[model samples]
Target: MAKKAYIGVDGVARKVKKGYIGIGKNVYGPELLSTAGMPFMALANKYYATHYHVDQDGGFATLELDTLVSSPADIIGKWWPDGSFGSDSVETMITSRIRTAVSYSGLIIHTEAYEITEQTVGIARKIRKAYVGVGGVARPCWSGGELVYYGTATALSVARQHLAATSVGNYALFGGGETTNNSNVIDAYDASLTRTNPTTLSAARTQPAGTAAGDYALFAGGYGSNYSSGVDAYDVSLTRTNPTALSAARTQLAGTAAGDYALFAGGYNSRGFSAVVDAYDASLTRTNPTVLSTARCDLAATSVGNYALFGGGQISSSSSSAVVDAYDTGLTRTTPTGLSTTRYQLAATTVEDYALFAGGNASGGYSTVVDAYDASLTRTTPTALSEARYRPAATTVEGYALFAGGFSSGGYSTVVDAYDASLTRTTPTALGEARDQLAGTTVGNFALFAGGYTGSFSNRVDVYMVS
Candidate 1:
């Protein structure tokens, strides 16, 4: 049996060598086996011992036995022996003491260079991965750690947690946040998870929010020395441009794409928790929409095909609130089902027509409860995250909604969870570092979490492969 399925180094599954390899069998006796050259594959079966061997050039060789054997195909391998058995045991046994050119013994295994196939490599069911050697030699490379091949393993790029992240097409940019101090650093990650700090933000802003607008991306209000009103915009060419500031500076806000516009809503301003909802057109001009029904900050937001919704946040007095706000493509405001569990500093992401809200701080403490909202805005509670956390990051990657890194009840978390279309939650992998207050976005097939408060505020970026 030939295996066609393989997971490449890029985390993409592929099929290789899509045709059958012909292996014909021929039995060799004493005379034919003595001078057999090149590599030969042999299968010893029960019944009167008949050895079926095929040479590298596909020539057939045979070995006839007088006695009967109990088992068949037990010692199946391709061996390159020089006429003499030397120290070979499986071949030496050859019908229990029946002498062959190789050896005369029992249960002899070919100690010389030999090859095994997927069918006989281990328990017959598992498909063995084959490595095509230099110069076109193909052989099974399984059974754990036999040889090391370059360019066959997955690669890791820098992880930028705690920083705000947004993507367009095949690239994602992470900018600003606390890393040692409130960081001014800005970087970009490509579809392959490669990281490069191509440009700098005009201002150092932490806990900022961003969304893609046309071919460009806008980094809206964040916390600098104080709440920031400055907005930074980057286009397809990575050009840095300025957009008008919000009517008031704010940080920890939730921003999402609404039709062709980007809307930034509820967060803290100098005046306290903000109810201001700022909408920006493609030109980055500001348009104030109806404010959030409930004034709050540290909320999470995500856009469905037609609208954007903001869910869960801290209300006026650092108190967690579970209220939700839905904005139509026209920027009209409507109330949706509140979170089953009241929470703040939560995260949300969408897939198809369903949006999932996960991991936030509730009344008692940090909450691990997860809730999903369908197209009609009905709420369905999914399985909770592996760890209860607050201020984690969320995004859609390869059809799965991912939540990564945050401050959990156990402290800072590096845990990452993925939700499939069925709303089933699975912890596929962990972030490189533990942190929170971060931002996340998707580009191509990847979901990324960047910049967050690890110990004393961090600027780490961690990536996960969802494809």
Candidate 2:
């Protein structure tokens, strides 16, 4: 009898031919279930599998086929080979409930570093759990538990938490927030995603907004002993400059940068919800002009390409709002586009071309829904965060957009949900401490979440590597 070994695909021994073995449905190439390219093949009753082969280069190879289904309802409750939603995952290319189309969600599970990518997913019949890697690529060994949404554990943090953030070149910088009696500290994160204490801001304040122009980074308008009109500027060398004060004193505003100009718009001062906009140049000089159509506070602001978008904040009638305003580099304002959901105290960021508004207080209380928009301000399908929250900090690092620690219905939270271009959400790692009212920024692939109120006040800063 010819020597044979158990084929991993069907659990039946097959005679080894030279260095290769032939086993699988239809006896197709090892990469497929069928010659026509169906990755799925029938196994036990109601059980199907997609093949995974460990390449000689140590990478896992699998099929990403578009297979047709008679109706969307057919795959409604069906589980994918990797156990993630085959049809329902937001990043899934297949979302047809029913159509002339097909689905491709089950083809790719996740890239793993198990050093042991198997040839069969027929474990659908024998197992209910599996291992998944965390922290980007897995190392040489298993470093994960049972498959879960976000592989997270406690990580390190800076001494401060509620600090403001802005990026210059490949570094994310945190500056000026409340700790004990509002601090003027500055912590800079490098391209490798490490944090170092840089020069502190001249003025101490909390809730200041930041935007950068070329090599110059500006921090403006936060609460000191009281609402402030102060504007402080920093160069790439970490040197400081005192610019002309903002036209009006304010706090809790939205800010953005374009060209060499940075604009701070809409905030609550003693006047309560002012529409004032403060524009600063590379020289650290101020220009008070062009107000937001709606005056509100606690809004989120981010710049995409040549435009800055301000979205969702508190109004006089109520704190929760969905109003979004877009501005050109020339400071011309377009009519605000209402967000799909009305919420205030949300956080916003842009990853590549897509701008996102995530987590805030809505009519039903805290929200997890994230709204994505284009340059024209049109909204796309929204995704949800792992947890509903308010006052989360938002930024983009490498290719990932992240919303960090914030206040939820349960109180201050440390959950950090990272988003991809498709609004796919994942938890990287939680903050060292649970906090809210924090600020975040990205430099290249480095991210920093810093300074916020955690019961008392904290100066802790948490950094993450996005690449």
Candidate 3:
């Protein structure tokens, strides 16, 4: 007599080989019973699935198959097997809609993990719910099926303004600003949102430009005792070192990183407003790149994809300039489409595929304009800020680019405007204090707004967190 077992097919129990199993749309048959089912015969030769279970509805199933060579519990930390999307180490897995491993333990249905950008979690609710079957392609995990976030406040060790900020590895550093006097203070916030004060800068200075390349955050060229050309580099351990100095000493220069290079460009030097550019590679080796098309100070800089852009600055004491200079990974320079309004003191940051320049003094008046440039350098105008302001500090966390605390007709603003990856604008909680000339940076899931003037120097650090 032929051994037979029952499997639910389309909600009906059907007789099949004893070793046969079904998972989602894939059915498997035992080696000896390879000819048993017409629909499953082709796959039976390929998969040696000895163990499986299906619910009466047949919509949910679990299977132990030979191809994976192990059980789900053993598969943790393994790269998901999919060629088209490449792969990522499985960071986590969840079994239910509740979305947490601890909360959803009772649900038998399991979800598979993939490495999609974590910020995509906000849009995850629009995706259809799915289940995983071993040896079959699984849906990519976005935020492990749900989203939640909270905010925390941390204070900078020192109250300061006009500082430079950048994140490298696990640390967000705010360096060189105005305190009671020029500040050498370098305040750091780690991934856990804990604050620390690292070694002070080599010189007390204000308006230094900060950017990161490779593992180091470099703060360069600001006014100290005089227009200074010093460049300080900090590695992952928060160890600081003086790198080769900038080609020229300057203040209010625009700094941004692209590819392996940290670039400091266009500022007022001792000579006059200068168009010089200094580039530092991963090893802190300095190189002089072709200068900006227009020499100006207070230009905002940010990188999207392969290009770093420096845009909108004060051309002279009387006029602002709208010219935008772009540099690719190779250090080749080009001019992208200019800003919609000629403005300087605008804030710039990158989120997802867009680099945004927002709100600055245009000609003489505070401007609310927000110009966005996609990876191709194509420019578009997003919604204007709710408030007209200039010199707002900007940074990105998750998919949100936040422009916070700037000077306006009303005085310094506490306003924090956030633009999501889709360019939609939302107002998050305002800063803990009304401030301008602050420094903004991010570490882990937190966006930190720290150090600015609010009638007085502010050490207040408002952190926005996304989980």
- Stretch of 10 with least lDDT, candidate 3: 115-124
**All candidates' lDDT scores?**
0.66, 0.65, 0.76
Could you give candidate 1's per-residue lDDT for residues 1-467 as a string of tens digits? 12233333224333331211213244233122221111223323322223333221222233333223333232222232243333444444443333243452222211122222222211112122335475784533421211111111122123234467788666787777665456667677776767666567888777788887777788888888888988888887688888888878999888888888888999898788888999988888889999999989988888775778899898857577888898888989988889898888788889655888898888888889998888678888888888888878888764568888888768888888877665767776577767777677765545666656666554455566532
Each prediction's TM-score versus the true structure: 0.65, 0.65, 0.72
lDDT of 2 by residue, 1-467 (tens): 11122223224333211121123333222322222111233333222232332222222354533322323233334424444445543223232221212243222222211111233222212211123365773322211111122222122234454467787766677777765467777777666656676667777888788888767788888898888888777788777787888888888887887557788888898878988888776776677666887889888888776778888888975556778887777878785557888888898898655788888988888988888877666778556899999888888765568898899878889898887654567788788778898777766535666667788676565667621
On TM-score, the candidate that comes out on top is 3
Instruction: Sort the predicted structures by lDDT, highest score first.
Output: 3, 1, 2
Best by lDDT: 3
Task: For candidate 3, report its TM-score.
Answer: 0.72
Query: Which of 2 and 3 is ahead in lDDT?
Result: 3
Candidate 3, residue 129: how far the Cα is off, in Å: 16
**Residue 418 displacement (Å), model 3:** 0.8
Each model's total of backbone clashes: 31, 16, 0
Better of 1 and 2 by lDDT: 1
Candidate 2 stretches with Cα past 4 Å from truth are: 1-161, 192-196
Candidate 3: which stretches are off by over 4 Å? 1-109, 112-152
